[model samples]
Target: MSVDVRWLGHSTVTVDVRTPGGSLRVVTDPVLRPGLAHLRRRPATPDPAAWAGCDLALVSHLHHDHLDLPSLRRMRPTVLVTPPGSSDWVRWRLRRPATHVVEVAVGQTRELPTPCGPVQVTALPAHHAGHRTGSGFSRAPRGAEAVEHLLRVPGAFPGRDLDDLLLWAIGDTGEFAGSDAVLAAAGRAPDVALVPVGGWGHTLGPHHLDPRQAAELVARVRPGVSVPVHWGTLHPVALGATMGDRFVEPGRRFVREASRLGVAGAVQLPVGGSLSV
Candidate 1:
């Protein structure tokens, strides 16, 4: 089987899985807007209409950038998958009429029916927080050891009602367990893995993977093809061309590291670029 993968920007990726019957398109984290809060999307905003035929949309977390309400409003995916306990928020946030939303947790798998065939989607563990605050600054925390510790504790934000509604963690044995479950549930390595290599910040915090770490993940997942994403799309407006390199560097670094790690079929594509694998 071969799939055409497109890097739309940030955590958004569109995959066209071709089969003997027909084609099925799956989109992950559809954030098609130009600007959000202090972060301004870089050039080449993808056409929103590109998402019209998406059969399945997967949202990794509740962060505004990944689950932008405005962006989701424009999309018309047949089914939307979000982390467990996120259906209510997703429904409330969306401006348009309701779309079919499915809540999935780590290790849970869903089979999406398409004209081509049945495509299995397993919700794998991600080492990132799922908390979302109205203020963007609250979501982008800095520091190293301290932040890492806080992120490891799922739903660390005490007394915050929203945090209580979602599960988030990293640097924990449970994350590994969930990953193992996903692999076992699939019964084989996935055809393509969309891994987040970096974020829109000067330095990566806990629960997030840099280039080297992302490559390590690819080695573990052992997918037929691994594509590096979550980079080269958005940046802080205040930094303004000073740290412009951060946007593109992570993806490039991940490609080099994936090659060094001997991951089979590691591929990197520019934003708005597509590759058939």
Candidate 2:
């Protein structure tokens, strides 16, 4: 079996998990607009049809860049998974109750049914905080908990080191002390990992992973394929072309750093690009 992973800029990813039984498409953090706040997407916004038929969508957190309501409403996957404490804002703002939204907590597993087979989703711990100004009554869900995700199919890929076709989407986060145990929840390395390597502004700072840290994560997770995301797609408009390495270098830098760390499978996908593994 093989899976196609597409990096749709920032933390947004479309994973097409294919198996003999069937195919399941999972999209993460759908921020599909051209611009938001001080940031502007450098890549073309994906057509809604590109993701409209996804089996499941994962929301890492409620920051505007990750959980754009307009983008979600446009794609409208069969089911949506998010960290706990996100329902209220979606219910109030999204206003699309017809969309099946499941609130999953860390360590909890939920089975998502598709036409082909059942896909298991497990929320993992992340080390990011959602800041709020005035209760999030205006925009974004400030109280939502951010999380990483481990997606698996019971028997998709055959003749691999792992029986199940496991993939991990490591959303926006920085290194934390107990992260080894957190990553150990899945018991083993995933077949594929979509990791954030940079932020939209000057630096990723301590709350997010820069290229070097992202490479370190690859050293730890040791996934079969480490696909870099969250870089080379968005930039701060004020700086114009002056952002230089911060805006345009994380993906390649992460690959290089990972290689230096002996992680041979680290790779990069241009925004809107997909790779099968």
Candidate 2, TM-score vs. the true structure? 0.92
TM-score top scorer: 2
lDDT of 1: 0.63
Q: Write the per-residue lDDT of candidate 2 for residues 105-214, one digit (tens) a residue.
A: 88898887875688788888888875433454675556678888888876667776566877888778888875544357678778888889988887567879888998
The per-model lDDT (C-alpha) reads 0.63, 0.79
Candidate 1 per-residue lDDT over residues 72-177, each given as its tens digit: 7778777777666666666666644547787655556555565565555555555556666553543332211111100011122334443211111122111233
Q: List TM-score per model, in order.
A: 0.80, 0.92
Could you tell me which 10 consecutive residues in candidate 1 have the lowest summed lDDT? Answer: 144-153
Compute the lDDT for candidate 2.
0.79
